[model samples]
Target: MAQSTEAIFIPHHVDEAFEVSYAEAAPDFGPLARDRIPVRSMAAGDLVALVEIDSRITGRKRVKYFERKLQDALSESDVRVSLVAELDGVAVGFIMARVDLGEFGRVDTTAVLDTIGVHPDYQHRGVGQALISQLLMNLGTLRVENLRTEVDWNDRVLLGYLDRCGFRPSQQLCFDRSLG
Candidate 1:
């Protein structure tokens, strides 16, 4: 069978904003043996798993901090979380987002995909693309206007992914400092 690049083997449903119902249920996409990459909401109990994967893929120093923040963010009614490519209930990669229903000072409401990471062990396996594409599709489904994410210069893989999602690199800098 010709596999689908975008379709996940685990079973997934889209109701109100794509919040996960239960990790206990079979993945909406399908079996990992079929090479399908499933992206599902991450649970607070999954924090350690999230941190370990994120640190390796992002090459960042503060894995625990970010993981904790993500867990905290998920607690809010306005926030949402997602994970990707689970070999079986274990999280292989993940994405988390915040859908601010309130309009920004001068901007419309937005779905900010705070983080998306595929464990270094699973890079280049289309997990990252699947997760991002899923997130963008969800945003479109919600009729959101603006989407923004911060990317480090060192994380070129992520920058490239954003570009593929039709996000441009803005030339404007909010602030900068010099140590001279």
Candidate 2:
């Protein structure tokens, strides 16, 4: 597929600017499951459902966080990627990421996964995997080279899931200092 060289503005709080283009859907990877779960690009109306899914998974409401993240992603459609998995037209899982080019002086284009959540009822039902698989397909359409995310070191469940998804320790180390 031919690529376009349009500039994208990722928010300064996360990273700098980059050239981006809307991705076209890649070839289907066969049916993702016996029970078909539809995953698609997030629409603005998905906000409430997304927040509800996350809240159910975490056992707490985080309306503002999701609101801001969704707004940012929708505002910068060329660079940010947001996807939701639905069963019978109800959202059960979601993943949000933004494409970064040369972030921190690196040249390769990377997708920084900001957040992903699967409702507890939907866990182990391939919803999360389906969401990820579709995200990867979409990223390939945009020519993104890698997918990066941060997870708490002690969160073994998430780590195992990522491992199964083919994630390994990245060459770049993350540093942090507590502000007291």
Candidate 3:
């Protein structure tokens, strides 16, 4: 067999040859499942469901705690920001938050996310994101500039989820003192 040399030429286009175009299907910025899930302000009727969801996650029922939170969320705030994610017309997840006009003499308005819970069956779905998205929208409309939450350092799963949802460490340091 005779040895032969072959040169393959590939075609290239100049920048001017074509107009800049975007992809027909837009990039996946984030999950759209959150939009499909129905997120709405928590109603007085949602307390039972909220307590059930929390009990499932924490292995204990805190009816009194949820009762107090729901009361404050519904009655104390002029605008309700706490939300529940519903699927099949049942509450599957909830985020309890409150708008603080000022804390420690800071004049800026901020939202304190006291608690969030999603049924185990709904975990890893967009239920949590939906609650957060609705909460953010509600807070934004109220002119609240910040949302803050505290998670135990040991709870890595919750930490990772919040991190994915764009939460970062705050500049303020929290302290606690024993009253006993």
Candidate with the greatest lDDT versus the true structure: 3
**Whose TM-score is higher: candidate 1's or candidate 2's?**
2
Q: How large an RMSD does model 2 have?
A: 13.7
Task: For candidate 3, write residues 1-180 as lDDT tens digits.
Answer: 011244433347646665543322221212354578988888999989999999999999999999999999999987778889999998999999998999798999889999999999999888887787777766766878888999999999999998877788988889999999
The digit string of per-residue lDDT tens for model 1 on 63-122 reads: 668766665667764646344557667777777777776543545667667777677778
Against the hidden reference, what TM-scores do the models get? 0.66, 0.79, 0.81
Q: How much lDDT does each candidate structure score?
A: 0.63, 0.79, 0.82
The digit string of per-residue lDDT tens for model 2 on 1-180 reads 123455555555753455443332223223454236788888889889988988887888898998898998899656758888898878899999888886777899888888899989989988887888788777888888888899999999999999877788987788999998
| Candidate that would win on TM-score | 3
Candidates' RMSD to native: 11.2, 13.7, 12.1
How many backbone clashes does every candidate have? 13, 0, 0
